[model samples]
Target chain A: MPEQNFPQGTDRRPFADGDGRGTRSDHQARPQGVTTVRRWSNWSLAALVVGVAGGTAALARTIPSHAASTTTTVVPTAGTTGAAAGTTGAAPASGTTGATTAPGASSAAPSAPKPIAVTSPSGVTTYVMPGTASGTAAGTPAGGVAGTGGTTYVARGDT
Target chain B: MTARTRTSAPALPDAWQDRGDGGPIGVAERPAIGTTARLAAWPAERLHDGAAAVDTVLDALDRQASRFRPDSELSQVQRSSGTVFLVSDGFAEVLDAALRAARWTGGLVDPTVGAALQALGYDRDFAAIDQDAPGAVPQGVPAPGWSVVALGGRLLERPAGVLLDLGATAKGLGADRAAAAAFRAAGGSGGVLVSLGGDLSVVGAPPRGGWPVAVVEDPDRADAPPSQVVRLGEGALATSSARCRTWRRGGRRLHHLVDPRTGDPAEGPWRTATVAARNCLTANAASTAVMVGGADGARWLEETGLPARLVSTDGSVHLFGGWPRSDEAPVDVSAGPSLSLAAASVGCRR
Candidate 1:
């Protein structure tokens, strides 16, 4: 694949009907009597906007929990030490789904139970440390190209 | 914390922590990505192989996305003033993730705050930065914001002043990618879990009891006690703390988790926010956003029904949705030489 580029300002779309000239001419051709009709139309539009806005407010007020609260019981294996011991009485939670904002909601987050504090397991944290690299670029590897479109999406390999 | 001078690849063998005791499950830890990376898997013998595979992906991503590295692709993009640039697939994915997070949070987690971070004295690795370094003079110019970025496939168009930073999502994304790579290379048996700092991701089949993760308020402080332990059957968990990676500026303490809207550290009563989701990326975004969202964070988590645990500035703990209760006994995740690998290899019956 070859790299492609778009000139700046391409994100803006041009007007239809020959670049706005035809649309302007059509607007000018409207009959003068239509001005009164336009006023009535504007009032009707305002009423519709208010109605929709009110309905949206009502919908926002409803709090919905789509999933039934399912709990998993965690049992501690005997002889477990440190924080792992505290896992015995803990309840497993249903995984997270994406969230959308609700209007007029309280700014502070709702509170839940306080978590038990346990020391970091000495067994895991005791591992020997390794040396760190300053940093390096992943320049095109043997299987991938640099800037050319020849690059393959390795990250999505399993997906 | 500022960037610590990158040393060299971790020493072989000795550098790999062996938490295995002839058990079916093997655990290993290595220092990488400016933090500790822990990998857990079944079949103890293959643990090192999995870690190596993950390192390949992470090392590449670090080079591409790290802002601390002058030669990184991100730094190059920042230097492309008013010009269009081409990016690697990995770099593009990082940018895409950051963009999606901003959009999902309504620009609450915007990546355009690179300049804001630099202005706050976070230009280098956390370890290299001076806590009492002279405060930065605000450029008076705000970020160009995420809207002005035009990313059409691999081609990226910058509006001259905008700076791109992947700090918000890179670690979690790396964890996800590393876990996937490790699992794929680990053969058909066992599961793989990778933790880069506090961000975690898992792939493949889990052990009979699932992986046990300790939720801690401050990840930077390895000595700080864990607040809770939860079994992750599958998916990721990420915790962001406003208390960590902080420095004193003009007698006021500041942290690295910057709020793009104000070009300043987020003002919230909560000191740390931890969230669990289907992947590390989403979990990280939600955690960071919640830290900045202040009082609104809990409501958003509740409305979304995402299980989360938060620690307030005064050291109070709060849970939302179905986050595991703190009172429950923690599951045993210890690995021994004799633990049965059959659970991962032969497949355990539910």
Candidate 2:
């Protein structure tokens, strides 16, 4: 009769008497129901934690070393030579390579790519190569003496 | 006719001068591309035609590569951040030369310093920049690095917020272009010299004794005699100086040459670098790299086997890679009239 008085599906048991103590059967049923619910919650929580940890570890393994590094790749155009493809790191080191203080004395010689002269239909000559040339044939003889009559000036500009 | 005395001023229309020796060479100059453009052509009659050709090349270059121009192709590329953009052949050629210079110089001469330049208050033309403007100097912003830019054929792609400034190579390319065009305009027979600002290029056949180039300390001081005079048989000559195109911000003087690594004006023992190479673009790149490379630049220049003249901050001159020495004594400003020529004709034959 007391059990029938309790609400259906309620885990909370009613007091058996004025002393506020649950009946013997009510107390026994409450502990088993609580343990069962707590065990299920713990298992679910543990599975979720394992899944999340596994995912994080997997993601950590997939990252590339150079993901943080900046890389530039330039495909050589029609007339360029030397390193058909080149890649420079994020921060290029200064004065370590490419050039030296003395001619023909560089320990780390820079690549010297000859420029290919391309003559357009409009008579414009474009140097298509990217690197310095071995020599040019357009100037006066290299040994020609300089004269005073027709001298031009080369200086820094405002641009 | 006796060669009329030439004044060290921008030689516009009426100012064209004939060589006092009455040689076939005539010199003409005009303001162009935010700087002065000078043309020296053989057969005095060809000077006008050469000038026209030079103008055409410079105008085209300005429209294609100027960072200060809102509608320039470079500016459009800047705005297209993170998008692939197709470039014209001319733009691609100039850009290729810039990248090659970057690669050849080990990134010492970078084109990606546009943002850094703007941050330094050089966002507009040098003449328009106010040195005394009130503002705090912004923190140095290292360039995005040239590596961030990708160019394949006419296609260019870069990350968001990357700005490209072709100031390093565009002028030289323009000079080279102008010289070739001028040479063609001159019937493609006689020699033609084109100097945009101080990037000088020559094509066809040089004069009897090569083009005599006066390497001066400061281009603005055109009236001051040069420290050295060199001869370029065919190639190109470019001079990069920290003393020119300078401004002040936050009480500190800044120059146009920004070290992409530091995002600030380059500071070095050498105040100026003048280089001669097989072409204008190469010459400009080497000279600029020398200025930006600072103390290490001299050695770098020597390695390239190109002739160079470097002026120290103290005004001392050092020459390398077979750069001819000046026979004439250095002019003293204190000694009046001796500096009348503006540039002393020191025979640097060979």
Candidate 3:
């Protein structure tokens, strides 16, 4: 078998955990890196001062500086709350009985995108509701086209 | 094929009349990608430029992936069966994607249905397909299967009689590509949403309240009211319906969503299944698979945790994966609103 070089920093998981950003779950195990940022900032300033005194501007450019720390915060939106409460206009039409929730869905409005199964009149189970998360599939290696970023979707049938 | 013949005038419904009305973003529409495409972008000034970028990508994909065109790269591969043929990067990517899809769905979404589609009188463009004529009986030949084809990097080798049909997957891939390109063309400072025949992708930052998309049962049904309207900050949504692209074969109604197991059109309980995935391609695949899997499809989607919305043949609606339930009354087929205006605007030049 040809060796598949799974790209670094790409989520190769079979299912999308969330918005395709990272595998980090809803709960963070550790706090944001405030001390790390301070340390890096001090080191960079010291290096710049030394380089400038030595008149080696080129050396300063080549020296590695720790990346600036960035923090991301996730906030609940009105759409989510309204949909969970079944009050949003976007929700399924009410009084249109026979809608079934997925097995994994929470009773409360779903915080993460979850799969839904809807059965038909023939009693044949036949539906999965889509979610709003993006670029969450296991990464498809870059090849064959110009643009990259986003997950791949495929469908087939038994006929 | 020439550009004129490539993109025919869009035949869209009047239901699109008030979509995105008064939204802060600018929207542009054009007849391309074998369907009407809408590009909604922030910073209204970049809307036209973003649409143009999408058009370029779609046009190139059309040339490389159009199975109907004898000169297309995919056609060349079909004709060059039994030999290793060097294909375009786009063709290779699509084929690779098809193979991956087959593996992903465990052969549920096979690309080997090309012959089956052709046998069903879908040999030409959908417009040129003879819907009234009876479809031919399939030869009972299972597609060579995805395993028979080998991809050595960019080179592809397929046995003779192994025809490939990208269909929904190609459209999904194209939508993903177009959406990403359009977003980048806007200097990545604005959000961009690309909808190709209802299979869409949203990238960058979405407008306030997110991108409002009305999901309906039959996209071709001008009289059909939207089953639901959902917002998307980013991601993709696709609807696959047995009710559309339909024809009569021996007085029996048949549609394009085929089952690879029988080499014939699929007959399922669900009239339409819409799926939302991290990307357009997966959403299209899941939606189409739901058609073949029928009741089993519901279980599979649930197990996989993919969100979806499905409408049954009896017009009973179903929702899962956080798909909201609307307060609006159920769609009354007999009393559903009609296309009040025949001349609905589909192409909006920025």
Q: Which stretches of candidate 2 lie over 4 Å from their true place?
A: A1-159, B1-23, B328-350
Instruction: Between candidates 2 and 3, name the one with more favorable DockQ.
Output: 3
Two-chain complex of model 3, DockQ on C-alpha atoms against the true structure? 0.03
Q: Report per-candidate TM-score of chain A alone.
A: 0.23, 0.31, 0.17
What is candidate 3's local distance difference test score? 0.56
TM-score of each: 0.65, 0.61, 0.63
Q: How much is A48 displaced in model 2, in angstroms?
A: 99
- Model 3 over residues B1-350: C-alpha lDDT tens digits? 11111122232222122122333455656555345667776655566567656756665566556676554567666665345665555666666666666666667777888887777666666655567865454443456677777765456666676888887577777778788888787787767778777788777765443455677665555565555555555577778888777777667666777777887777777888877776777777777778877887777766655667787889887775655454321211111111111111122101
Error of 3 at B202 (Å): 0.4
Q: Model 1, range B1-350, lDDT digits (tens) per residue? A: 11121122232243456544435556667666676677777655557668767767766666567777655677666655445665665666666677777777666677888788778777777777677855544342355678777565565666665777677677777778888888877784567778877688777765543455677765556676667656655677778877677777666677777777788888898888877777777777778878878887667666766667788889887866556454332222121111111111121111
Q: Which stretches of candidate 3 lie over 4 Å from their true place?
A: A1-159, B1-23, B134-141, B327-350
Cα misplacement distance, residue B348 of candidate 3 (Å): 42
**Candidate 2 residue lDDT tens string, B1-350:** 11354343223243233332334566766556666667877665677677656655655665567676555567666765345666665666667777777877888888888889889887876666796766787667799788777666556555667777788787887887889888887787667778777788778665433455666666655577655443444677778888777778878888878889999888988888877776778878888888888877777887776766688898777766655443211111111111011111122101
Q: Candidate 1 residues A105-158, lDDT tens each? A: 122312112221211111100111123432222353411112223222222111
